[model samples]
Target: MTPRLFAALPVPEIFHKEIRRLQKGVPGARWRPSANFHITLRFFGTMDGKQAEDLDAELASIAMPPFDLTLQGSGWFGKLDPHSLWLGLRPSEPLAELNAKCERAARRAGLEADSRKFHPHMTLAYLQGTPIEKLTRFAERTGGFVTEPWRATHFTLYSSQLSRGERNIYEPEADYPLL
Candidate 1:
């Protein structure tokens, strides 16, 4: 069966608790639960069995040095349009390299490049019908929000399954560790 999948960095539990606490205070935003929080290096919409195998093989071949990624700040994607709420990743070479590696792997696996440029962020919420003005003000107020830093040790290849519910749940199909 084809699975909706992506490569992601799973946040540690301690960090997860902190993020969840902060997200709870936001008004009118549909926040992603802490268990669903992750930094997606590449999003592969859906793939057949052979394609999934190919993607997994390609991901396994990617080699990058490990890095400490700081999860700081909250913001919205499509600021004017206001579609998604996210937490920004601090600028770091290792993070960039990892992102590039994931992109290359996707291309090699015959997946289309993500239309949106890779801006490292952990998704906090998805706007249902929130207005941009209020969203912008909320994002601005929380922009500099920071918690403890966490290390990104590995990236996982996830198989996402959609339900009739409000959120999509993903399970790891494979994992590639950073060197």
Candidate 2:
């Protein structure tokens, strides 16, 4: 079976301790392990081997300088019925440009255009029937959350599969450096 693939910048470990502190206070929220934390650039879905190869080549061709990104605030996806909690990122033009490059690579690799607009955030947890009030409170309490700016020097192509317990296991397939 083809693997579900995506391009993302892995969260640096230095900030994991602080990030972990905010993982609590929300009941019934399936917290994501720190190891899985990443700011996704583009999700390419399941791709056959040939398409994967083409994508790898296209992604490797991306040329951009490293940029600094800062984590800021917190939010959830669903307004009426909250689905997931996420940590937001401060606006950065370099980040957006990199995302656009990843999108172009996916298209050049024969993947369909992504319909969802790009929003840069690292998912903190997945919510299931989570109370809207609790989600709101979590958002409010963590509104001032911010991290020291981190340098993103490279992006990775990852293949993810559902392991036991339905948790995603992301394995880095390739690393593309920004030089």
Candidate 3:
């Protein structure tokens, strides 16, 4: 069976509480379980058995040193369908390099390249009819947010499915450790 796949950096649990603390006051905001938090490296859409193996090999070939990452600040995007709130990440050259590598890996695996630029952030919630004012206030409340630097040593391949509650469930398919 073909499975939808994505490559991402896992958010360490030490920052989970801070992320959950901001999940208030936004009506119609579908807050995600902290379990779903991650900084996506690249989305590979759906891949068949052979394609998945090829992508796995391409990812395994990627060699990069582990780097420190910090989750800081917060914001939201869109008023239409893709409306969502997110916690921002401090930009890192190493992260960008890894993301570019993931993109190239997707291409080598016979998948179409992602057309959008990589913007790293941990998604906090999906909004349906969240008030604009509440979104602004939530942003202001989280403005001073910062987390201690943590070592990012690996990335993972995840597969997701829609659950009974209409929530998306994510499961780790594979882990690719970094140098």
Number of the predicted model whose TM-score against the real structure is largest:
2
Question: Is 2 or 3 the stronger prediction by TM-score?
Answer: 2
Question: What's model 1's TM-score?
Answer: 0.91
Candidate 3, 91-173: lDDT as tens digits:
89999999999999889888897999888999999998777888888889997888999999999999988888989888999
Q: For each candidate, give its TM-score against the true structure.
A: 0.91, 0.98, 0.95
What's every prediction's RMSD, in angstroms? 1.7, 0.7, 1.4
Give me the candidate number with maximum lDDT: 2
What is candidate 1's CA lDDT for residue 54? 89
Clashing residue pairs found in predicted model 1: none
Residue 125 lDDT, candidate 2, scale 0-100: 99
Candidate 1: 10-residue stretch with minimal lDDT: 19-28
For model 3, the superposed segments whose C-alpha errors exceed 4 Å read: 79-82
Better of 1 and 3 by lDDT: 3
Instruction: Between candidates 1 and 2, name the one with more favorable lDDT.
Output: 2
- C-alpha positional error of residue 104 in candidate 1 after TM-score superposition, expressed in Å: 1.1
C-alpha lDDT of residue 91 in model 1: 85
Candidates sorted on lDDT, descending? 2, 3, 1
Candidate 2 lDDT, 1-179, residue by residue in tens: 55799999999999999999999989889999998999999999997889999999999999999999999999999888888999999999999999999999999999999999999999999999899889989989999999999999999999999988989999999999999
